[model samples]
Target chain A: MRLALLAAAFCALAVPALAQTSRPEPGPLTIAKQGSFFIGGREVKSDTLSTLPNFDAAGTITVDQMYVRYQAPAGQTGVPITLIHGCCLTGKTWETTPDGRMGWDEYFLRQGHPVYVIDQVWRGRSATDPSTINAVRTGKKPVDQLPTVFSAGHEGAWAIFRFGHQYPQVLPGMRFPLAAQAEFWKQMVADSAANLPTPNPTVPALSELAQKIGGTVLMSHSQSGIYPFQTAALSTQGVAGIISIEPAACPDPTADLGPYKAVPILVLFGDYVDEFPRWAPRLKSCRAFAAAVSAAGGKAEVLALPEIGIKGNSHMLMQDDNSLYIADILLRWIGKNVTATR
Target chain B: MRLALLAAAFCALAVPALAQTSRPEPGPLTIAKQGSFFIGGREVKSDTLSTLPNFDAAGTITVDQMYVRYQAPAGQTGVPITLIHGCCLTGKTWETTPDGRMGWDEYFLRQGHPVYVIDQVWRGRSATDPSTINAVRTGKKPVDQLPTVFSAGHEGAWAIFRFGHQYPQVLPGMRFPLAAQAEFWKQMVADSAANLPTPNPTVPALSELAQKIGGTVLMSHSQSGIYPFQTAALSTQGVAGIISIEPAACPDPTADLGPYKAVPILVLFGDYVDEFPRWAPRLKSCRAFAAAVSAAGGKAEVLALPEIGIKGNSHMLMQDDNSLYIADILLRWIGKNVTATR
Candidate 1:
């Protein structure tokens, strides 16, 4: 209904006199290949019983598990795009909005880009042994004894995502689709807590996936931001471009970023960024990192939407009313920057 | 372009065979009466100083000054709607969006509601002598030397308004029109700090204004929320109804709400209310107050947008993309409740 209103308003303004013409139907999406892979593994043994073999054969554990949902048209763009969701969310982030709207996965697919939405190790379809991994890392058994993870409650998300100044008290000019929050929260899942903070274990797995899929554009959100940069640095040939949205942290400012010199990196920020105490400093860090990347001869650009007439966007611009608008900006950036690298 | 595409999509879905029809332009707004008025005042004198005759014959210091901009169509609703802006913002909150879109002021006017936008004492065009007020109230000189107030910078607003999770990091599902931040920030003015927190001085002034405009619906936002409820209680005969949006504080739950028993009240909550630390408890307090009103035989209703499927709104819902949708809801509530009280 809202879309219809927007459309009616637009039509009323744009072509008041012109008669409507037949609209084109979007082509169907085809599944090129959809599957899972176990990329990284290491030997694990009990601290008290070192002689005992692990649960699986070869006395090893493959903790870095990834599940991919691949979709594209018959004559899709040669360059493929890989999407990684932020913490507490899975690949469903790219599939549908919390309010029942189409997500970027379909948008990108319709735009002719082969899309791969993935669930990182221990999330969504990916499986993991948290007890064994936690025990191996800490040399002790789990303390909570709860195997499953927890979702960030709907109320809790209000603050974490900056949806409003305060819960039950929305600020002026907010654009988050209020009706869709229930569905969006429902998509959240419980994953291994340890894996979310430092996704080092999944770095090699992501890098390997990129290599397996050939040259691809890596788009990472929130906690997943570090993975693309690490993946690009590790397997420079596999990453054609990188788009990180309000990434938690940036690459070491002074560290060698030679591998990233050929890849184009774009970091996008939504409106009202300085309200969070952490984001201001984090953005500075990101700027410094981007400067360092540029200084190291990489093509890196940081975009603050407010500076460019985009206002009142939350950190979750992907699911915003103007998500397609921002997505188009990213798509244009990719068109200009990724073509050469590919 | 986005709207056009949306319209095309809707046309395709709704009326595939029918040709487009011309949309009628909205009619112009008719001004009924627009002016300013000074309400409450008291005389002042310095201690141990030689007495000098004050400028006014009444030895007046009108601390609570108010400027009103009233508009209505040729045939308008008899029940007038009085608008009070939050802290820092003036009556312009109803005029236009930070991004140049039409505000609820015009929308409400078109909806046939006689609208009255007010600049509260010491805000907008309503001027006051802060030093005099401070001296009269505190018996000392003004402490802070800052001449004008400063608004939250664009970056600060993101977190302050919960537009994003962090500063410069918009979360997913935000709908704030990103292009208008600069203009919006530019409109924020430095208001009298003394008046914003409590706005105690303006209570009588607002009450007086309500009396002059008989049986008015007092609509207040943010900082102005408390005033409407207080004024409604003070001038029971003048206030027919009250609508508070994301109000900071609620009336004391334990207080005798006899005056309000005759007036209908609606407290509307925008998206992400639980995000701010104060909101959860604040909402509880508002609920308690509403419940107290109900228990005391008054008409009161509390609305949470999420509960009704409206999601992802920020603190500022009036300037939001779907401000009209929320406005219509308020109008409907007013239509049903205000009529009875009137």
Candidate 2:
């Protein structure tokens, strides 16, 4: 009889705890200072006011600038971290998650690190000029000359983000808050990378930002996975460390690995990569790149969450239900590897 | 000796309170749900993949979609509020201020109103096709045919945002956080309004959003001040109330005021308008529009902050130092004027 009663009590306690959808109330946030700025854009002149609809046009315009927002905790002890988002998303990926949980930005801030979140050049708050499109519509430019912009369809993103093999299908044990799937779709935006120059303007702009902040740990995800490596290759001035999460690609293994020898690099992967045809190959490439770094006497760690017993993470690991748990792992890695060169 | 000691104690207590730059720690926030979505965009087809730089450009491309992010408090009581930003800004206008104070979106959510913040069509997260620009750059189109895109210069925004009469000049008693001026400039972005159709695609998208949300209040600022009015003019379907904050323009006084007759309207202006050449005329025009609405049996109130003893406000009233104090007045107006139609 006593055993039966205890069993009943255990079920009662465990069921609700496991089923509860709401997150715990976040503690009060007190920051020393928080603000935003634009960096690394050039002036482009236009004199076609007669064809433009608004009177404000037809002058020197700034294009290809990057927008950055930052928050610093009071009496900070940890090194500053700069977060870059993946494709079809902006800096909001690092903000409050789709499910209302505290984002990685605030979590890191609370952990004593300053966080800088950016919208890549020509995306989000980063400026893009629309003159060419306007000219085409007005018949001054040919219809065939339209720039190619990409917006991910639901099915494509479902597979790409590794929520499932297809849309409306949840990968068993996937850590993504599937109930908040609608919110996840909203994070996708139109990306104009096809219109940018080779190497992309964001790479150089990020390098400039690293120098501007003196030195910052560059953390990127998915589409921007290779940016930190590319930035480091260009100039190691302020590239302290690189954290690449579920990147679509990594640096070429055969490329000069000299720049990465001094700066520590972490290539992170979520679960279910093996299930997706595209992500599986990408993961393999990343592992090979990490191995190349190690072979070149560089500090490189390839962390597959499943291998570490932290399983069921989606492409958006930072936004998953157990995001903080994963963040703690990254924090430990940073503490051991990334020294504040500033 | 007793009197002197009391005075010293008062100074010790009051001085720090007055001069302290930091705001009080924000209380713990609990929300029932939060998410985001895109609405109202058309797919543009392009068969000229050979001329395009990337492989993603050959298919149907979605363009001119508006991005909306929302948060609903647990057991909401107040009407939903839709916040639309002005020129060169996105839905970020309603977010946490650059100076780290709690934003109006959270304030209203805490007050039990669900809040929807939107990036106007072709702005921020809203997708804009870059194909035309790409074509022009590749010499497939003429250079003179380039579309006109506008970006606010720091000096011009200073004057237009009412921070000062000119660049690097303060309007004596302006309440904009001058120390954070750099952050304010960062809010500016490259706007492609010149490429959009007349009446702008955002007008219809907002109307659709209103209908989708059932019934909600439409709140706009500066560049977007006229959107709510225009949306209402098209269809009063789900417009519960309209709040216009220092808009650049208002509906023509002679235009049909019939649509506004059944809806409540609040046209609000910040201080220092009469001192600026550009703003003085705009304020006068708004007052005339409000008077016309009242004359035509519509409920419209034109409020100049200075007239109500609230002084030193800049154009960005929602981001000023005493933004909460101003928000209180808005809340009072909303309480008395807006009735939840749903």
Candidate 3:
């Protein structure tokens, strides 16, 4: 009966339409009977990663599009997990160092988890990647890829003082520090050299990818974790649990995190980082935020940072001196925390 | 022309496979058009938790799925970050206990990461949920799920004596003690209930789930993190990064843990956990395994337990004291390390 219905539907619409990433809504639409994708003369073997992108182009984006890989046990199939990098960072940082394979990447690899490293717009390898902002500057390397503000009247102190650079862009409020931009570029080159993919909202792109990987979990560091939080909150079928490491920025829920459903979430960190005086406010903010997640029924907790002297105060817990200590907390969190309860 | 093609394809096939995770593979006789999944569906969409075993199963099994209710955002996009609970505790412990939320979930949720929670197998609300492992047991609660034994006949005093669990059959060699299984279960169920999932190769199931989540990261703790390791090592596709904290067991890679691909990985623990006298060999083995992964171009790291007494020996880092410290470390690592490099 199923086959007959499909065949009839096919026969009714003898011709198909040409579409790509963008689409428009029409009256009385039937997604079920809509044209399915097929490459070449033969029918598409599967929604293989290669073919799925074309699908995302067919309509609006979906949460299932992201392609994080997963392998399952007999009764326990795994879902996909995503790794979003922080500001100016590529996704690969979640794995190894710039040289090749490092400690953390190897840990995940050994444990058997996939890592999707993406460069956010204007950072890392993505310095040249395309986005709504960069679409206009569509030229070659740095020149075309650099933010428009750089060329405009927003030249930084370094640019103005050093090379006699001038920001006569004739626009107000566009100026930013050249140091900040330089910092951004530095992170990008490192990530790019190491083959890390830049993180982007690229939700539509992910929807196609999701079909390829079994399930996905969003893992973000610094600013990237924010991507997953936003992703999950926006769609009905978004990411699963998130392993956020000093992820900056997230929206608070009016209701609470509980309704993201009963996701098996685990929020962890090093004590040394939290105790540092420099990050007290951030710590307070983080704690209050995590508390909200917990109040709504999701699991959230912060680990204490090492003593100030034990590991340098540094910018964050995982960074600076006691690097290994931070890794331990994250690895352990993944090992013991995330799982399906009876 | 595109519309024509779609009409032609649609006319031939009706009732398009709605929400099919993947298309079935054609017979071998059929030539493959696309080369492979490389460079196709690549997105940062980490997903977690699902009732259905595979991604392709268009039918979603709500029994085991997390039920989420999206709420308005207190801030930006309303995309909140939630946390999932592990083996023994409730979400409440994380936010309002002697410690605090540490901003683990709420931090991101507030910045846009809404916290979510999950009950472990045979523990908390999950135990009562008929769809989860709780249904497999045989008792008023009917203990359904069981643990995965890498060692065949490795029994301990707990299995045979303390909990007094009788096995249908033990593996070939390696017996701990008659009390092995019994004691292990007893310890597992201290605050939580005793339950574990049956062990299997796990590759296929995990792969299927990954496809659904669009491939996300798995941030786990204790024994559960092992599953992520297993999945990442053998996944058909690459997974994102995996964060494990205080894993119950670090199986020797030589014993398993397949390829060193996917994304980045981090394995960590407190100095005490690293010094865990009982499993020195395992920890050593983990280090060696991580080293091996690093050599293979995967990032892997080992973080020993916290040195200072502030955060002492404890299985659950996020749950106990020093929660804030731990959260900071996570934020730092993800931002600095993972983002800095691949």
Q: Of the candidates shown, which would achieve the greatest TM-score relative to the real structure? A: 2
Q: What are the clash counts of all predictions, listed in order?
A: 55, 5, 266
For candidate 2, what is the interface RMSD? 5.7
Going through the candidates in order, their DockQ values are: 0.01, 0.15, 0.01
Q: What lDDT score goes with residue B257 in model 2?
A: 91
Worst lDDT 10-window in candidate 1 chain B? B48-57
Interface RMSD to the true structure, each candidate: 29.1, 5.7, 28.1
| A325 Cα displacement, candidate 1 (Å) | 1.6
lDDT at residue B150 of model 1 (Cα atoms) = 30
Candidate 2 lDDT, tens digit per residue, A146-184?
666656655556777888886678888888888876666
The numbered model that scores best in lDDT is: 2
The alpha-carbon root-mean-square deviation between model 3 and the true structure, to one decimal in Å, is 30.4
Q: What's the true lDDT of residue B128 in model 3?
A: 19
Model 2 C-alpha lDDT per residue in residues B219-241, reported as the tens digit of each score: 99987889898899889999999
Q: What is candidate 1's CA lDDT for residue B84?
A: 85
DockQ category of candidate 3 = incorrect
Candidate 1, residues B21-100, lDDT tens digits: the string is: 22244433443332223344433322311111211111112234455545454467647888888765666567657565
